[model samples]
Target: MSEEYYAARIPADIDRPDAVVARLTFRQVAIIAGTGAACWLIFTAVHRAAPHLPLAILLAPLVLALTVAAGIALGSRDGISADRFLLAAARHARRPRLMVHAPEGIPPMPSILPKAWRRAAGPRPAPLVLPAAGVDGAGVLDVREHGYAQIAACSTVNFALRTSGEQNALVTGFGRFLNSLSGPTQILVRTRRMDLTGLVADLEEAAGALPHPRLEDACRDHAAFLAHLSAHQQLLGRQVLLVAREPQAAAATDAGLRLSRRHAESGAVLAGAEVSVVPFTPAGAYGLLADAIANENPGGFQ
Candidate 1:
C-alpha cells in the first residue's frame, strides 16, 4: 500500500471551517431595525419639540443604545428570536390537558367557543407499568421489563442505638457482603411520612370490643393520645431495600433455582451482619411502588 493512500481523503478545513461567521435570523434583524428606527424617530421629534435642551438630546441616544444592548444580550434564545421561544413554550404548556365529565342527571354546560381557544384533543392518561409481574412459589419476583428475575426486600436497623464496636462490625460485615456480590444489586433507602391510620383503626376496634368500661376508656384515651402525637410530630419512616437481580438469560426452569440461591445468599449475608432482611413478594413490590409514588405526589394514583 502507498503511504499517501493512508492519509485522510479530504482537507480537515473543507469539512470543518476554521472560522465561522456570526449571523442574525430574519426576526432578530427585523426587531433590531424596527427598534432603531422607532428610537431615531422619537429622538428627532423630542429634539424638534425642545431645541434648547441639548443635554437631553445627547442622553437620549446613549440611553437607547444601552437599552438595545441589554435587550440583545438578555432576550437571547440560542441565537433564535423570542417569537419561536414563546410559541414552543405555549405548545409545551398544552400537554397533559385535562377533561371533565358531567353527571348523568345534570345537564352539561353550554359549549361556548372562544376565539383564542384551539379545540385540540385532551391528552390521555399514561398506562402504569409495575416493576414485577408476579412472584413464584419459590419467592422470586419476575421483573420482565428489566430482564431480571429475583427476590428482594428491605432490611432495617437502629444504627443510633448501636455501640461503636457493634457499628464497626456491622460496617465491616456489610463491606465484605458487597465485595462478595457476583451479580447486579441495588441498595436504596426511601423515607416517607408514617401512616398511623391503620394503628388508629385497630385501637378503635379494640376499644369497642373491650367489655370493661375502664379498660375501654383507657384504650380510647391511648388511641386519642397516639392520634394527637401523630398529628403534631413529624414522624418519618425509613426503609432500606436490597434488590438482587440475576440475569434473565437463565432457563425458565432454572429461574426458581437461581432465585433460591440468591435469596439464601443475601439472607445469610444479612444474618452475618446482624441485620434482619425481609423478602418482598410481587404484590408487596407493587404496593411499595404505589406508596412511594403517592408519597412523592399526593393523590397521584387516584
Candidate 2:
C-alpha cells in the first residue's frame, strides 16, 4: 500500500467579515442603506415645502451625487475600502508629529516664558503611552492593570527541507503545544538589521591561534569576506519571540508564578519539535522593549 498525505488550505484573512445581503458585508449594507435613507428624507422635506414644484427634476442632481459618493466609498483599492482609507488618512493628519515619553502628560509651558515665545514654540508634544509599566529583576513585565508578561526567544525549524514523516511529527508536536495553552499566548516575528562586526572581530582574534599557517590564512580570508559583506550589503536577521501573559490577581506573586509556569511548559513542548526556547534576562528584556518602542516612535522615549 502507498502512503497518502493530505493538506488543508486556510485563508489568510481569517477575520474577514461575513456577507449578509447580496454578497455585501454588514458594514457595506449599513453604509448603502444609510445613504439611501438620507437621500429619501431630503427629497421628502423638499417636496413638503413646495407641493407645486417639480420635485424629481430639482432633486435629481443632488440625489445622483450622493449615490455616486456612496458607491465610491464602497469601492475598495489595494484590498482596503475607500471609507477606511479616508478614516485612516484623517487620523494620521490629526495625530501629533512629535511624541515624548510622559506618563503624567506633557506639562504646560513655564509662566516665566513670554506668551509670544510659547506660541511660536508650537503645540505640546503627544505622550507615548507604552503598555509595559516596568520590567522586574526576573524578566517579568508589569503591565499595570492588564497583568504580567514574560518573553522567550525561540529558534526556527526548517520544515520544508525535512522528510514527509519528520514534517508530520513536527506538525503534530506543534499542535500539541498549541492545545496545551491555558492563557493568552502570542508569537511575534520581526526582522532587524544584522551586524557582523562582532563576528568579524572574533574570527580575526582566533586566526592567530590556529595550529597551521594555512589554517590561519583561511580564517583571516573568511573574516575579511564577512567584513566586506557587512560593509557592502544590507543584511537582515529574523527573530521569533513567544510571549505569555497572565491577568492581574490579588497576589502579584501568583501572577508572576503563573506566567513563569506557562513559559516553562511552552519551552518543554516546543523542544519536541526541535525548537530551542531561551527566556530573556531582565537586562535583555528591557533592551528588547526599548528597541521595539524606538522602532514604533522615531522620536523615541525622552
Candidate 3:
C-alpha cells in the first residue's frame, strides 16, 4: 500500500472583487455608468443653451475625454485600481504632516505665540493612537477595550529539508495546533537588520581568556571575520512570533489569566511540531513594540 496525498488548487486572487457584468467588476460598471450619465447631462445643458451647435462638435471631445477618464478609473496599477489609488493619494494629501504620540489629544497652540505666526505655521500635529495600551511584567499586552494579548517567540522548522513522511507529520501537527485555537491568534513573521558588533565584541573579550594560545588565536580570527562581514555586508535576522489574544472580561485579572493559559496551550501544541515557543519578557515586548512603531511611522513621531 502507498500513502495518499490530496491537494486542492486555491485562487491567488481570493480577495479580488467578483465580476458582475460583461467581465467588469461592480465598481468598474459604476464608473462607466456615472461617466455616461454626466456626459448626457452636459450634452443636454449645452444643446438647450445653443441649439445651432453641431452634435459632433459638442459630443466628440466631451465623450472622448470622459471615456478616457472612466477607462483610467477602471484600470489598475500595481494590483490596485486607479480610483482607489487616487482616493488614497487624496487622503494622504489631506492628512496632517506632523504627528505626536499624545494618547489624550493634541493640545491647542500656545497663546503666547502671535496669531499671525501661528497661522503661518501650517496644520497642528495629530494625535498618534497606538493599538497596545501597555504591557505587564509577564509580557501580556493591554489592548484596552479589545483584550489582553501574549506574544511567544517561536523557533522555525526546516520543512524543505525534511523527508515526505516527516513533512506530513509536521503538517499534521501544525494543523492540530490551528484546530485547537479558540480565540483570536496571529502569526507574525518579520525581518530586521542584524547587528553583529556586540557578538564580535564578546568574542574579542573572551579570546584573551582562552586556555590555549591556538584557541585564543582562532577566536580572534573568527571575531575579525565577523567584524569584516558586518562592515561590508548587510545582514537580516528573521523572527516568528505567535500572538494569542483573549477578550476583555469584567475583571482585568481574569483576562490576563485567560491570555496566559492560551499562550501556554499554544506552546504545548506547537511543541509537537518540534517548535519551541518562548514568551517575551516585559522589557523585550515593550522594546519590540517601540521598534515596530518607529519603523512604521518613521519621522511622524517625535
Best by TM-score: 3
In order, candidate lDDTs are: 0.64, 0.84, 0.85
For model 2, residues 1-302, the per-residue Cα lDDT tens digits are: 54445567999977778889887888888888887788778778878888788967858876796777677657887888877877888999999899777767888899999999999999889997777878877888888788888899999999899877788879888988999999999999989888899999999999999999999999999999999999999999999999998875555577778878888898899899999888898889888988876565433322
Lowest-sum lDDT 10-residue window in model 3? 293-302
**Residue 62 of model 1, lDDT score:** 58
Question: Could you give candidate 3's per-residue lDDT for residues 100-207 as a string of tens digits?
Answer: 777678788999999999999888898866788888767888887887888889999999998777787788889999999989999999898888999999999999
Query: Which pairs of residues have clashing backbones in candidate 2?
Result: none
Q: Please give the TM-score that candidate 3 achieves against the real structure.
A: 0.83
Clashing pairs in 1: none
* Superior candidate under TM-score, 1 versus 3: 3
Model 3: how far is 275 from its true place, Å? 2.1
lDDT of 2: 0.84
Clashes of 3: 0
Q: What residue runs in model 3 are displaced by over 4 Å at the alpha carbon?
A: 1-4, 52-74, 103-106, 120-122, 295-302
Can you write out model 1's per-residue Cα lDDT over 1-302, one digit (the tens) per residue? 32221222666545322332245545555666667777777777877888788867567675778576447633747655455666788897875444222222333333685534423522333334445555555556666766555546656667678766677667777777887777787887878889787898899999988989999999999999889989999989887877777766465458666655766787788776886667776556556655765545322221
Cα displacement (angstroms), candidate 3, residue 261, comes to 1.8
